[model samples]
Target: MNLLSKIDIRQLQVLKALLEKRNLSKVADQLGISQQAVSEQLKKLRHNFDDRLFIRTSNGVVPTPFAQSLQTKVTRALASIEDLLIAEEFDPKTISTTFTICSTDLEQTVILPKFLTLLRKHAPKVKLAVKTLSLDDIDSSLLTGKVDLVITNPMFAPNNYPSTTLYQEQYLCVASKDNQDIAVQSSISDVAKIPQLVVSPSRGEFSGAANKWFADQGHPRNVVLSVPTFTAAKACIAHSDLCGFIPARLLPDPTLKIISLDKQVPGFDVIAVWHQRSSQDKLHTYIRELLMQAASE
Candidate 1:
């Protein structure tokens, strides 16, 4: 039999424990094995290495000169083996990989500024890739690793994917402060009659969340313009007489004023979604945490 084949990992562990403790009883206690078992492993290690390894004294066993010479090499070998058995811990500072996120303009305006600040502060080396949220391509994008995360309203999230609600958002009926047609306090029927700007990011159709509310009240909205993003809608609404409903978080704008309605539009949840495969991913977990923090702030 080969000398290398005769040496087992258990025998090496025993050898290391014995070298550190210099006492069979102490090594057994530390290793959770019996003293006799410790001695048996030591005996096998001695035979395999062809060295007495330790000499018994009145106090305890002490390593021989030959064993002392093997100490550094054995420690290094054990460390390498441990590296093989243990998982490497995730470190944000050391990460240099890019993370891609698909987000609507609402999230880009309201959530990502603070998120980017936190991400840059902690993980300066990590690169971020932002893609415009497209309902048509989101499923395949997440499944194929083209997108790592999707931040959007819960209504727009891909079905069956795992998601965490970052925050709840309510809609605010906003119009240009210069617009004289709308008032600070107006009934839903009143606003429904005014020419509205509908933000249809996924589709160019003049439809929106407030449409259902208006229809439920027997007064369908008069949507005159359709824009692809909230940013675009905001810009258009500020200059034109097209009043629109935007998320409350995008308020306090100098050019826009909120239109208080008799009935409020239903609020929606903003969520972070990822592929099922990334349920246990450390980087995804960290990013989600950062997203929640950003939303809270």
Candidate 2:
């Protein structure tokens, strides 16, 4: 039989405690075990090592050369075990992780700049990668680690992912500063007479809810231009006679005039969505909070 095999980790721990305190009672107190228990562990340790590990002296006890030599290795091993058991608390400033977020052009222009600035002020080492979302590819993108989070309408979000609505986005009409039709007309029929710019992010199909709304009311829109993003729509509207709908949250430029449409275009719920794997992530949670704060502001 191997003597080392007979010795358990508890015996090693007791030996370490005994060496440090140089007293049996102190070792028991430190380990929260009975004095007899400590003595029994020490006896097993002594028998295994074939040494009088400690000897009583006038002060308390003196360690043998064997005990002194074993102390360093034992302390290091126990420290490592402790490290394995305790989880380190997260600190954002020291985090060097890169988060990839999926977003649309409107969100990139209106939301991300503020979010990035706030993130850098606290977690300077953390990095961000912004990618355009392909609604059809969301499942693979999230599962394969291509994107960490998505900022978009919850209606278009993947069902399996977790999401929180950051804010409600309402639509408002925008026209060029000199567009006479929009400036002079307050009725939906008169507004419909002017050419309209439409945002068709998926296929630039020149058709959506606005057209349907007009059609439902017996007057269809004459969509003269179709663009893929809000930025493009804004640029086209500012430079031409076309009028278009945009999110109310985005700040308008002086070259464009914002019009409150008489007809109601259903607003969307902008949500922050993430994969199931990141549901409990501390950093991801913090970033989500920051986004919510930015949206509220």
Candidate 3:
């Protein structure tokens, strides 16, 4: 006999319902079938599994050890099949899963606070873990489930992952409050002459638009420091004469000054990305929408 052609999915579902409900009538009610229909399914299941499966008792029925052993596997298989056919609806207030995010300091500072506040109001039980976006293998991490989401510059996002751009942001030149050169609004050339701080999150020795801007105009910046994070660059600018360009949305300290560049420095799009596998996940899509809303605000 061909085992594949002999067993039926409906029979497996009936077995799962029997294990949970433990009575013919209750299983029929739960499955929207009649008690007679349920018995017919159980009869087929008995022939397929070659066991008594369930025994009649005064309390209704009891599972045989064979049936009991198959209960967990049968329930899991049905649940997996159901999930493939229908997306489980998400109610944020009741969800208790933790979501891991890969991001940069700028996004963590600017985006996470608002997202957390929203989550507290709605999804109080949901948790979040924010880690640095791996420069080497973020795509693999996302695809393999090491990370659930990524929030960063769209330019840096992996092409294979599905992404939504939240907002477009430009960089603003920031100088310490007491830094006289850029404090009073100097030319971009003069600003370049001052010690500059470069943000290179990937730790690559490459030039950004500002550097290229200076080079095209026949002068390159005197880059005094290169850091792997925006927070480090912020602290460096706040304490020393070094000046750096940071995302404009992250309003700088009231004491610090922002200077306009002579030539527009190209800006980047901020985006939220996730693996294609999670595209249909209700919670993932909900959080992605929340991020877009917060970024807009």
Question: Among these predicted structures, which one has the highest lDDT?
Answer: 1
lDDT of 3 by residue, 1-297 (tens): 986698888888889888988989999999898899999998988898889999999877899999999988988888888889996667889999999998888888888898888878888998998898666667888979999998877657788789898878888888888777565556777877888888777755446546876788877889878888878878788889888888887765775688766666678888888899999888898888788877877
Which 10 successive residues of model 1 have the least lDDT summed? 201-210
User: Per-residue lDDT for 103-193 in model 2, tens only?
Assistant: 8887888788888888998889999999876767777888898898999877568887899988888888789888776763356776778
The lDDT per prediction is: 0.89, 0.83, 0.83
Tell me how far candidate 2 lies from the true structure as C-alpha RMSD in angstroms: 5.4
For candidate 1, give the lDDT of residue 69. 86
List residue ranges in candidate 2 displaced over 4 A: 1-85
| Candidate 1 structure lDDT | 0.89
Residue-wise lDDT of candidate 1 within 75-109, one digit each (tens)?
89999999999977899999989999999988998
Q: What stretches of model 3 exceed 4 Å from their correct place? A: 5-87, 202-206
Model 3 Cα displacement at 60 (Å)? 28
Please estimate how well model 3 matches the true structure, expressed as its whole-model Cα lDDT.
Answer: 0.83
* Best-first order by lDDT: 1, 2, 3
Please list all clashing residue pairs in model 1, or write none if there are none.
none
Clashing pairs in 2: none
Q: Tell me which residue pairs clash in candidate 3.
A: none
Candidates sorted by TM-score, best first: 1, 3, 2
Between candidates 1 and 2, the one scoring higher on TM-score is 1
